[model samples]
Target: MEYKNNGHIRVFLVGHAISPNRGSEPGNTWNWAWELSKYTNVDVFAYPQHRKEIEKFILEHPRNNLRFHWVTLDNFDPWHPEKGESGLRFHYILWLRKVYKIIKNLIDNMQEPIVVHQVSWSTVSTPPPILQGVPIVWGPVSGGQVAPASFRDFFGNAWPKEMVRSWRVSFYPLILGWGRRVSSLPLILAVNRETEALLRKAGAKRVEFFLDCGVPSGFGLPKPQEVARPPGPLRLLWAGRLDFIKALPLVLMALRRVRVPVELLVAGDGPLKLQWQSAVQRLGLSDKVRFLGRIPWDKMKEVFQEAHAFVFTSLRDGFGCVVLEAMSFGLPVITLDHQGVGTFLPADAAIKVPVRTPEETFQAISEGIERLALDEDLRLRMSREAWRFAQEERWDRRAERMLALYEEVLSHAHRRV
Candidate 1:
């Protein structure tokens, strides 16, 4: 397994959204970088806002193999996005330009060649440095997922903003001419089937469906149960940003149809918070559902342990890490049979229903909920399978897979030379 240069492979990783050790918050950029550093020397180019958090993590958990190069954006705070992501896209493009310049200079002076790894937002049409002659790896990119036509039709002619965003993805190949770049890429790691197809259509030489999401180490550590409380109703949990794409309204509709008495714990907040709460009252589900807005990341474990099942209603997601985390807590997931939710969960781990119409989606969800409520044995079996799947998806295993792909790309490049 010795590399061509006979030492640990050095990687110039370009990831703008990396926040090391921020588990409770979203984004898995830190986990991917940190885990890979165990197998390779990674010099990361990330935004400056993560500097304090990264510094704190480095101080507590030392790793000599990893180095952080903060790519600062002057006077502008893109991370906060308080202005509704108005200039976020432009800001990232400009930031990547700076990253390219830095890497281009470093690559010229380096003694040994290094691989350029673009972690997330692995668009085929990226900045120039990513397309250079050096062996390049782009992945876990999340662009091609589109919401079901049924979802869009039910919502209205206007189309939810998410659907509009998906439409924009179609222009990538035409505008960026990504196929030209894909023809030369050493490796392309797509997160979902839609992205895989898009990459292939873009003429990618080698494309692999690779998941870039995982929980932190010891994430599923079990705690003693407090089973002394008198059980009254079945508890269901749904946690994520309260956005249109999450399809929170559809979940509420499904809850209205459930035959058994059930209580739902909703964690997290977003722009649609007021609308969702109003919908609960409109549907007379005020008593059945409770909104615990923006629960702390550490406290999510307690919420998952209390629930018998996790119902995910996201119409389209690049990769749903929460679904996997719910599985780690031994909760059987009930989700639609599409996108990341369908891609990540095995048949045994979840009660996946088709997503064609609003009524159909909610009806299937209601039946799945009732099935879990009426059948204890079925729930137990599914929970066991979910936990098993989560164990198999640990971060270390994903890291090993990623490093192996890097080695393959580099060795192949060497052989060609």
Candidate 2:
């Protein structure tokens, strides 16, 4: 609880993206910097693309302890498609080199100790920072989850790409000599079980499991004493980028088997939008499903509030942040029992269907949905549990965990010296 001693501890947070206007990794970077500033002085190094949004937010709600530094390469865009994936990787490495020089210069002149925490672009494949004499905390990182082979048919034309990805995840560490680099880290935080297992297998000495996503402190506070069901047919919400990995078709197929009146609101937009829209008609679900493309982040709460339950069908994810957001709004979740959802979501708060044969999985999903639709008592119970679980994962609590990790790593570094 006592984060400040004689003065606040200084932290240099290295992340590629940090912005209040975005979600996922960019929002994650901003959240870590903002929340950690409550307990420490944070100097954030991020890409220049988010500069305007960050500045506007800071001007409106200034924090003396929080500062942002823009870091990028000259005449190079890391996200440019022409550069290709390899080019983007090279650009990230170059950007990080520039950040290292800045941090090294500051440390040479400063009297107080500093800690470097890389909070975003959370992937184990990326090279760790080379900051000697300064304590480093890597991750709550992910990228180890892979699509199941049993469900390869669901990926359609993307199956070949998925196969290549699965191969890379399994061997890239050894091929790139990440084993040596990872083993040297003082502390490495993993976001899911697969990532944690992979890190440990790669010879990491100290790896801790931690979720990469969290809700805001005031999110769903003053929990309602009673769960109120909206007067209508069972309303289910499925939200995510309409990507192949999301496997939206699983839910669509399952809906055909459900024996109850239910409506599914699909919220998001991506490459598969038109294709999935076609599938909805093909499956004869046009009457039961509505595609609400790309809802704004602030307005998503309205969508969640209207839904009776949340459905997560991500074949792979670091952790589905939207699942937590749905839970915060008192929606019981029905999700696949694998990856982050399988590892972190409380059994009491969700009905997790196992990853089995396609028909079996679809049937189970249908049964799960129908069960929740018919049993009001079960839905309310799970809703209360889901809300309670979300409250515990608030950003403030995650920040406390980070502060403690920083102290632990710093103490160990001092003992080694």
Candidate 3:
């Protein structure tokens, strides 16, 4: 699709982390700036630690319209922001203050139309820059999704932390007065239904739903020749940080219950790795599961290609980037039907089991796995549908939507005057 620069609008993206090598929110920020730059000028404000990788990437593949401004806090190592929760929050707030000052000055002198977009650390808990006069887009942000209390067993020692997080999500908006802070913004983009509701409740005047991540161009296209399914156990790929919120134990327990032969390939490592490995042995899944610890970003494509289906068991997420990546390889998904995964993922492209009591959910997941393993034609059809859905979610398309939103915000602001 062709996109024209209708207004010659310049965008200043305010993000704490922006990098070419990173994959989560940082990579997302870079992708947004890169794609948007194709249509208009973009100035990115990001942490200085990512400066090396960002500069090297731009050197290799140049874009004249895009520029990066490194923003950092005094006396603190931008590379290692304090490790604990409180320290990180304090550091981010300080960084945001520094970014706001720089952007405010730049906007004061610019002749062309400009908009400020907060694209990283997409959470409502942190207040956005309070810049007056210019239109500011606060999200696609999310922090509203909470892990189910019934599933606390899956979290192990982290259960208490989960409880604390839920409490914060419930009360932070009122205590911090987010409603008053966000009411003045022209637009706020929400990544999921939960967050959208939260924003509206907090008195955001205009909120729109937008997915937090998108696939790249030509990512999910079909290969030259379709390889026939090899004869073996159904290979189920599960890739994510093995933290408690991921709920890998659910998958392991479900794997044991599946009557059909299946093997799960886990491709990430985290604090719960040792505990999860022990759970595998306890559940007699040593033969059925393989932990392929922390595959590099570039190599993950091959891992996805080898697997027959992808399983995402994240209890709380804005949207799992890995789910989109898996679909890009035409892997049908088996995941819980909640949060972003439940709301955005198409039914035909996945077997989304409803979140319920632990035993019930486990039974449903096992059933979904068994059905897919036995029916080759069903899997193939879902694979095709998944690939087609992924194509529609290309980053360029997302950028186009963002451009339209910018125009809308400008029009509204103009009307107000």
Candidate 4:
């Protein structure tokens, strides 16, 4: 797709956690930045760890307008093994200072007006460092979404700790005072309704709703075809980080309740893998579950094609990208109705079960799985709907929306000046 830069709008996008070329799965930010650059001149400030990887990507999949600047500081990385999460948070402020310096210099030197856009780590609550007299666009920021209080114990060993950590989300209102410093808040885009509501309540002048992730190029290769659920068993696929928030143990417990024979392929790995594996043993579902840990994103395409349906057990999600991926592959999704995934679910494409107590949750999911397994017509219908939704939400479409939003912000900012 060719984008004519008629306005020649220059955008400085701050994406601290964005690593488009870091691993096999270039996340949403990578795809977003890549596509957005096609439309406008983008200077992306991203993590340094992905510097080499991004350089290689630019060589292979060249985008002349998109320039990547690495944001590096000694001993900085939120996920640093030694420093841990707390250390990363401590340094995040410093990182912001570095970003501010770079933006300040650019604003002073550049002839064309610059607009600041925060592309990744979408959260409406946390106010980024202010660039005096500059118009700022915040979010599709989405961190305020949380699992229900009743789900505290379902996270296994990390239960209460994870639950306790979630309480920090409430502090978002206390920090809204910081946003008052922003020169012009043209728009604050939120990924989900919950996030949109939070931003408005926190005194955001203008808040809009938009999804953070869109289907990347070259994914969802499989065409829709009649899938037969064999008389023997139902084939299901579950993919994503195996963390407490995933609520995967409930999946295992649900499988135990399923009367129909079901085979599950588990993808991705995290600290909770061993615990979930143990739970599989305890539930006597070892034979039914296959742990395909940490597979590449490409491999997931094949996995999706091989499965009859997809099960997403995340208690909370900032727009589950995998749900869209599964839909693109023509797999009907079974996910919790209490998250961002539920908010955008295509009509009749997903089985939305409420988040309930552990036992009830498991029962609900197991029952839904059973229904999908037996009803071939329902599965086929849902798969088609899912595919339709995915086709409509490609990254290019999302980039167009962003380009329009950027233009609006720039126009409004120019009027004030």
**For model 2, how does the per-residue alpha-carbon lDDT over 1-417 read when each residue is reduced to its tens digit?**
434544447899998877887888788888899989987789999987778998999899999989888877778655664555666777787888788888898899887778898876788887575567787789888899999999999888989999999999999567546887788789999888898888888888798988888997566535832755866689999999999899999999999999899999999999999999999999999999999999998889889987899999999898889999999988899999988889898999999998988888899999999999899898999999999888778888888888888888888888999
List the candidate 1 regions with Cα displacement exceeding 4 Å: 1-7, 21-27, 73-84, 122-130, 153-163, 222-231
Segments of candidate 4 deviating more than 4 angstroms? 1-7, 17-20, 23-26, 73-86, 111-113, 179-184, 226-231, 415-417
Give a tens-digit lDDT track for model 3, residues 292-410: 99999888988988899999999999888889889889999999988888878999999999898999899999999998899988898888888877876789989998998999998
TM-score of 1: 0.88
Q: What are the per-model numbers of colliding residue pairs? A: 0, 0, 0, 3
lDDT of each: 0.77, 0.86, 0.86, 0.77
Please, what are the lDDT tens digits per residue for candidate 1 over residues 117-185? 877455444623445657888877766788877677434444767566777777666655456766677
What lDDT tens digits, residue by residue, belong to model 4 across residues 136-210? 887777877877878777766776676665777766666645546422467888777777666666677787777
Tell me which residue pairs clash in candidate 3: none
Ranking by TM-score: 3, 2, 1, 4
Q: What TM-score do all the candidates reach, one by one?
A: 0.88, 0.93, 0.94, 0.88
Cα-lDDT of candidate 3: 0.86
RMSD of each: 3.5, 2.4, 2.2, 3.2
What's model 2's lDDT at 78? 55
